[model samples]
Target: MTVTDQTAAVTTAPEIDSEQLRAVLEYYFDQDWTDGLPVMPVTESSLAAFLASTDRDPEEILFTIGHLNRSLSVRSAAINAALAGCKPEYFPVVLAAWEAIAKEPHPARGIWQSTTGTAPFLLVNGPVRTELEINSAGNIFGSGFRANATIGRAIRLGCINVFGLHPHKLDQATQGNPSKYTAVIGENEEQSPWPSFAVEHGYAEGDSVATMFVIRSVVHIEARHTMVPEQLALDFVNTITRSGALIHEYTSTLLVLVPEHAELFANAGWSKDDLRTFIFDNATRPRAELAAVGKDALSNRTRWRLPSDHPDSTPDTASTTDEPDTVRLLSHPSSVQIVVAGADNAGVSAVVEIFTLNPPREIPFSSSRIG
Candidate 1:
């Protein structure tokens, strides 16, 4: 069967058993199914084992996902993750990630199942990073930990197997970012003096879970102690805004301010809102000026193309706001979301901002204590 793309072929999910799993694997092999490795088969027993790892009821409706125009059962997902080789302990984080992506505005269905080459990234917060042995330091996005490796693949498999999301069709990604095969997570907030992702999102600390979404490249914003708040913010705005933060409707930044860098902002009385406002005002660029940097995508005839290739979307805050002059420090505060993270070194801290509108939402990585 020629599956044109993810949205092109829609099929009802059949009961997945050991037999069907083998068949699918066989078909995959026949079709040369691969992303640098052979995918494991999604068997019923394997899925059951993953479900057994979680504390939630197997029947629990984690999310009525709308990505592929169909809802997913936890059973199906467990099976898919199991096939991807995610440990049973990774279940809770996966569950939370699905829920987060399923949030109406998050557009899990569109990006998850689309041919946009969009890949879901899991950003871990709270103290569970260490407990789960999630790597947030050097080579965090590379190989080594099973949690970081398989968790992302399992979700991708679910989007493929359950929702029928496929590459090159529904996912018309221009370059198909590396986040597709790699996972993104960091150290827990308990390791630092600042609040973790969950705490920032109004949840308690020490919760274990993951937040997933589509993302572009991640930018590292460094601020050594030599720079104060003004200088640090200035450095961050210049650094991140240069990475195509101008056109998307909503771009959530994962600000990994090393504690030292964070303290500069803290000392300057820079609240999150303050930083957002500053970035919004300064990140702007003149329309005439933006087109010079291969930003023809934001030109008058192509502006709408940003949100929907219609050429009506607003240009980057910098271009729209600073039309007449070139004092463009930056523009559009809404484009920025700041979060504290990183090792506590004496000299410098960093602000790692993931560029693009497909970044994950700002909810901290904490499971709701209600359950």
Candidate 2:
């Protein structure tokens, strides 16, 4: 049978009675369909509302899990959205996130089932941030906003129910991350000193876009003492280049600058590109340091010649002078994505390590417009 027909066959279920509705949470839990939390019931009507929010065909296949031999359709995604308590309007963002995941260079790499315990970190941009009230400031990653919470949870639920990536099973994380529960945030565009991240990625300023990244870890940086932008940049560089975290040469980072930190850089005339270049040039460790951390073998095995456009790329003719004693943390300047977020009360920032399976090249992220 075709993918559409297969999805339609399994997605159909008879409505439960009111008596059974009271025990819905337990019912789903017993079926091992929940994320170990109370999920909103996915009624037929609610699912219908979610499907109506998107123009895509309900039976249209979004992507397939190659190993599992399972496909997720638009209708299946809507069911998960409803179960996660997302408003009908929030469905598009969830769909956009899946679109981004589908664009991964090697979907069979099973990023969702990595042992690193990576989470689907979402960056929402454009007017939808305001329209959906996705939190962009003050405890942005913390709980409070429904849009940030449920939209993220919807994706997790789909992974569980659709692809069967349950803990200790398909998912083999040594130690899981808490953000695995939900991690979606919007850019504080109104308070940002630089252009919105989506715009930097070449999207129209008015377009609502969702970009997904697999985050291995989040390192919080607090540099309240520094007024100099370079000083603050160095603090971030220190965190990003930590020897223990430098498992592979292809690793990238998402630098989240709080409004207070962003303004400092703006006042110092440091653009995002300037900061990226600075980090790429300076975020390095002595080769001896990697050996001390027992990462020398892995580092030497993973190192490759960076692209010519990379800031630290060395000429083939003069390769002997390529800093044999040093190891650069970031492969390219473009690998470091900078965005403004969080409250302006403190000089705080966060470095999110992007998870990768050491693909042959920089892993491409997906940016889908929210309609």
Per-residue CA lDDT of model 1 for 1-371, tens digit only, reads 56656435444544457686677777776754434456776566667778777677776665555535666667766876776777777777677777766653434436554443556667777666776777765455567778788877777766666665556655566676677775656643544445565666666665654555456556665445464566667776676556355444334455656566666666777777786777656654444454554443433542322432434544443434434444243224545655555456543444444333333234322233211
RMSD of each: 9.9, 9.3
| Residues 167-195 of candidate 2: C-alpha lDDT, one tens digit per residue | 99998888989888889999999999899
Give the least accurate 10-residue stretch of model 1, judged by summed lDDT: 362-371
Q: What TM-score does model 2 achieve against the real structure?
A: 0.88
The global C-alpha lDDT for each of the candidates, from Candidate 1 onward, is 0.58, 0.82
